[model samples]
Target: MEYEMFIKKSSLQQKMLISFLCLIVIPLGVFGYISLSISKQTIEEQTITSNLKTLGLISEKLDIMASDLTAISNIYFSNEDLRKILMQPSVEKTYEERAKKEFLTKMIINFKYAYTWLEYYTSILGLNGFELHTFYDGRVEIDELKKEDWYQEAFRQNGSIIWVSDPSPKLARTVSEEHFVSAVRVLKDFESGAPLGLLMINVNESFLFQQYAEAMKDYDQLMLLDANGTIISTTQKSLLHQNIKDTKYYNQAKNGDRGSFKDEIDGKRMLVTYHNVKNTGWSIIAYTPFDKLFANIYRAELLIIIVFVIVLFLSILVSYFIANRLSVPIKRLYRSMQKVEMGDLSERTDVLGTDEIGELGRKFNRMVSRIEQLHDRVVAEQEMKRRSELQALQSQINTHFLYNTLASIRYMLLTQTAEKVDSVIVALVKLLKRTLTDENEYISVGEEIDNLRNYVYIQKARQDGKLEVEFQIDDRITHAQTLKLLLQPIVENAIFHGIEPKEGTGCISVKGWEEQESLMFEITDNGVGITKLETGGAADITEAILSRGSGMGLRNVNHRIVLHFGEEYGLKVFSQEGEGTKVILKLPKFVKTEELISL
Candidate 1:
């Protein structure tokens, strides 16, 4: 539950990364594990089978050797002289002396004839002092021979050969017999049914071990055991003639002809493959250390695990990269949206692509731009309503200008004729009546031009005809609605700052036209133009005259124009120090208040 809760709270990148790893890494890990396991099992089974085959080959070779031994023992049966010699009565001691010499001579001749064969020391111990021996120049007590283990065991086998290792203390073989494994059998009379003597064939244990020398390893052992689990011939000479250890493998091998088992022998864990030699009724046991047999499989398993880890690590990085691609754009867009929600209309996402996230970011940016446009228009409309009520009282900043105009009329009344004084009075009354009216903010281009004409006329009367005004408005837009009193202040500034300051008569031109979807107006005056001044005074006159996009009057006008329409409709100013000043004011072409309110 806690893990699920943690996952639920994770970021998108984390969640995607986790999911990818689970999908790929878990299954891959399990597959790797299973692959290693199957490889290990297969290798183990193959090795076991291979080792068993090795034991089979060894057992086959040993069986051939055993069969040859048994066959050689049977060869002695065809020797009529040896049989007749053993058949001599126990009471007749006359031929014993001559028989030993003749049998020894026959043994030497036989050994020379089969010199390449597994060399053997032959011997016979008989009843009634009929023994003929060629094994070693040694003697044994004939009275105590009945108690000898070799004699007793051979006698119990009737006529069959009994395999024994290092088996002569009573018969007393030569020094080499200590390392010899021999086959002993009792020879009996076929016609009389009476036992004659025991015939023994001794061969060096090296003969048995040499049969499998190529298959023997330093850590492995090969042994030939009788049906009773006695070690007859073994590579390890010390184990010859000893009873096989009581191991589970030996117990299992004794019950079957050929088989294998895992067990510990002589304190070392090993795999034992055993087979029985049919000719001699002996078992061939091969011991191989368990670890040495399968070391390669272990190394391969380790290497595969390492490769799996490297592959898994690479997959993790790819998973993270995939998650990053999906999550980063969303995060950027979300942050931008948060800023927009907090009223930052300038917010924009830098997320880039042609995917869905990129489209969403672009749509969000467009939506914010539109919202800012609507916010500005709404603010402008509300502010315009406030300004309508507040601006009705003639602005205090214009009081000095009004008083000056009144003084100019007084002067006109005193110095000029009644006709000139009446004209000034009429112009003053006309300007004041229009400026103070509580009407709608918009008026026709003709009415604005007429208003500017009245203000210019009053100024011209005061300036003694030094100022001249010109209008070059397009007739196509003469009846177009525009803001009231917008041009009056511009023309008044031209008279006071441009025309009055000039030594000769000066001209102010007011021109209006329609361009594209906007209204363009240019006001030009032939007077001393604007300059960047530290203390020269008249920067406010420049602001009022040229609409330089700064200061109170023109900046406010530009702000209002931009707010009402968009960023594309604003004011532009160009001025030279001595040539002239021109101001271009752009507004939405003949936009009605109804359209603006609906927008």
Candidate 2:
């Protein structure tokens, strides 16, 4: 219930990923379990059957070798040439010693010429104490040999052929350091029914089962055990002649002629096959561990697990890609909604999907656009109201200038001539046309200079020879556009504050030029400078100028420059007690007329 609740709470992407994992994991489990189960059984069965067949073949090989030893022994025991030499009397044997020695040499030659293996065979004349061997001289006394268990067993059998294992000291054909195993029999004369001599045929133990060791690489061990439970031939040299009668492998072999069984030997699980040779009563046994038997099956199980993990990982990635593709658009839409909730009406979804998510995103973009439209309309209305208030203030300043100029004209008409009055009125009319009218907020530099000339001419009329003015402007910027009354107010301030207080003729110079990306204008006068400049620095002087009674026009010009351009483009004032004031107007050059004309 908890897992189901978790799944229900998960996002669609997580749910899809979990479903994909289930699809991959469950099928992999079922496939691996079933495959390992069936293959394990099939591999074990085939391996056990194959080993049993190998054991049977090894047993047949032992039978053939045992039969060969018996037949060769029988041939030696019944030879008539051997009877003639051994039966000769002692008094006659002395004269026939050469003949006896020749007879032994003939026996060795016959054995060597007849068989490629050349098994060591021996013959002893019991009557004369003479003996001969194919490979080694007789090393043991005949009395001691007769006391051996296999020797007595052979004597008791009389002439019947029997096979026995001989694991003695190591034997060599030249030096005799190696020992030879022999199948021995007592030779009995058919005419007398008495044993004449002993016929011993030796076989090398190492040569037995030499071919089978290389062929049976998968089996852990291949052993040949005699009827007496002695290991005669085996792949392990340490187990030679070792008795295994008490072991489970031997006990199981003793009960059956030829068969296979699965058992635990010395803590190891083994598939054992055994075959008892019919001729020799010897058992051929093989012990194979279960791990070796199921080697290929284990490798197949590892391969299955690797493939399962790879497929599961790939399935997860594919599922995650699909789930993320489905959910990312919705997540982006949610984030965009959050931005709008925080008052960002400009936020819009840019989802690329064409499903319900895409429809929702398109709706969101349209809704934001609509909200932005309403916001822009409200902002425009508020801006229009602000502009109306600014224009009303500008009209008040215009009315104040007209009142001061008309007062000066009325005073001039009372005390001066008509020609001078007419020139002042004409200059006032031109100044009024440029400053008071709202036909254009900006004008070319040459037109603004004309406006300045008219205003200066009227000021000169007011103070006759008391004021002097000069215009020093760059001809290159004559066509550059700027505010219409950019310089008139500064020139007026210089005249009244700087030139009017001086005793000598005050000269005013208006200089305009380009400075990098801006237009620079300097209005200077040679007259009494600001007396307040003694009390403070340049900032205080500028504060006094912008905050004084007659400096209102200068402050308004500063405000207009800042409002039209930016804060960086405005008026700055510098003055001293004895030096006249200098006012600089920094303005932009060649502004795109449409951008700020409406503002």
Q: What range of 10 consecutive residues in model 2 has the weakest lDDT sum?
A: 168-177
lDDT, candidate 2, 1-599, per-residue tens:
99889978987778877887788788878979998998888877787778777777766676676677777777767778777666754343464765666666786677656766544455453534555555555434355455567767877898775566662332234223243345667887789988776776665556665636664696988888778888877778777778898887789877768777889987888988887889867788888888888788778878888988898889888878987888788788988999998879988888957888899899889989998999999889867854664464446436666677777789989988998888899988877666666556678999999988998887787676788898899998898888766687678778877888889799999999999978899998877887743444553376677777767778888887887788888888888777888888898888559655433
**lDDT (10s digit) by residue, model 1, range 217-287:** 73378787877787877777777778865856778887777777778878888877777777767787788
Model 2 CA deviation exceeding 4 Å by range: 1-375, 378-386, 389-393, 396-400, 407-420, 531-552, 594-599
Question: In candidate 1, how many clashes are counted?
Answer: 0
Error of 1 at 57 (Å): 2.6
Model 1 regions more than 4 Å off: 19-31, 87-96, 108-112, 130-132, 168-172, 175-177, 263-269, 337-347, 364-599
Cα-based lDDT for every prediction? 0.73, 0.74
lDDT of 1 at 385: 69
RMSD vs true structure, all candidates? 16.9, 13.5
Q: Tell me which residue pairs clash in candidate 1.
A: none
